[model samples]
Target: MALAKLKEAIGKEGFFLELDLADLKSVKQAAEEFLVTWEKLGEFTSYTCQWCHDSPLDQFTVQGYDLQFGTNTLGRYYFTMLLLPALQRTTGTNMTGKKARVINGSSIGHIDAPIEIPWNVLKAGSEDSKLKG
Candidate 1:
């Protein structure tokens, strides 16, 4: 659905790889699939995790890590590492001959994030979870 929208707006067919940032396995597969299709990465954009859980319960991703940490930290790190080679190939692959740069995007909401990681929150049903500011 998102690819269709992009195609309609750009008037050109594009590549799309299904990604679930919450799962490490999904991130690895997405990176692999993307590298298989594209030899070089001209531009790659990675954004911060935006999932917000308000159910009064600690949520865990399929990999058994905190949903947000798994998606925001683990998932992004793994995906970027796997794509490093493709990114490196950008030096002479693009018209501008520029190397690909990884961008860590964030929103204003980050200002309210805890200064330090609360270890207990990383596990599901860890009622002791408390975000330290």
Candidate 2:
């Protein structure tokens, strides 16, 4: 499988995490697992998060937000904030001879979204509003 190839490619240098961003519970569990696993590694150095949610809207999150916004925006924000302490720990220890870094990826199409977010629709999980790239 692709995961086996990735494990072979990284060898002993890194590991992969499996998480579902649309589900808050999954995100939280993944973060907890990462913390536990990395703590056993004895040091942390850097973290990279690459999340992209751009598909036809077909579901709503448990929190009543559109799937794309919930997963790509809110969920990613929550996950990153949760990991800050672990990232800070790495800097405190000078583990990699540098400060811990975080890299976030965004799509250029984001600029096309309306300046005023449809908060009401998002909060109410209303499908009346269509999302455009």
Candidate 3:
């Protein structure tokens, strides 16, 4: 449906990609492919991303890191880091030129529950009650 609508809307050829954001390897591969294609064509406009990792798992692990920190924050951070160069190239600017905005999909939950916890809770291996914030 989206493809048909896009074709109708554009009245020309359009490319669409499907991806799973939960997988780091997939994200990395997609970034690489985008770079290679952009390099070959020598034309790229901009890179945009909307990051949201609000799914709370009982316990999830990737590369031996906790899901909350790994998925909600760190993964997005690293993915942005890896793709910075390509994004810069896309916009025809160096790293220091324009600020590459990373719009985090932060929830009101953070503000709603303002009770501060110790930093160690974030670092501690145990996902205890105190760390549930």
Give lDDT per model, in order.
0.77, 0.66, 0.51
lDDT for model 3, please. 0.51
Expressed as tens digits, the lDDT of each residue in 88-113 for candidate 2 is 87774564566676777766656666
Q: Mark the regions of model 1 whose C-alpha exceeds 4 Å error after superposition.
A: 1-5, 51-57, 125-133
Model 3 off-target regions past 4 Å?
10-19, 39-57, 92-102, 113-133
How many residue pairs clash (N, CA or C atoms closer than 3 angstroms) in each of the candidate models, in the order given?
A: 0, 0, 0
Candidate 1 vs candidate 3: the lDDT winner is: 1
- Model 2 accuracy (lDDT, Cα): 0.66
Candidate number with greatest lDDT: 1
Clashing pairs in 2: none
TM-score of structure candidate 3: 0.54
Rank by TM-score (best first): 1, 2, 3
The top-ranked prediction according to TM-score is 1
Off by over 4 Å in 2: 40-58, 92-96, 125-133
- Candidate 3 scores a C-alpha RMSD against the true structure in Å of 6.1
Query: Candidate 1, residues 19-118: lDDT per residue as tens digits?
Result: 9988889998999898888888877788875555342235667977777777778888889999998999886768876677888786665567678877
State the weakest 10-residue window (summed lDDT) of model 2.
42-51
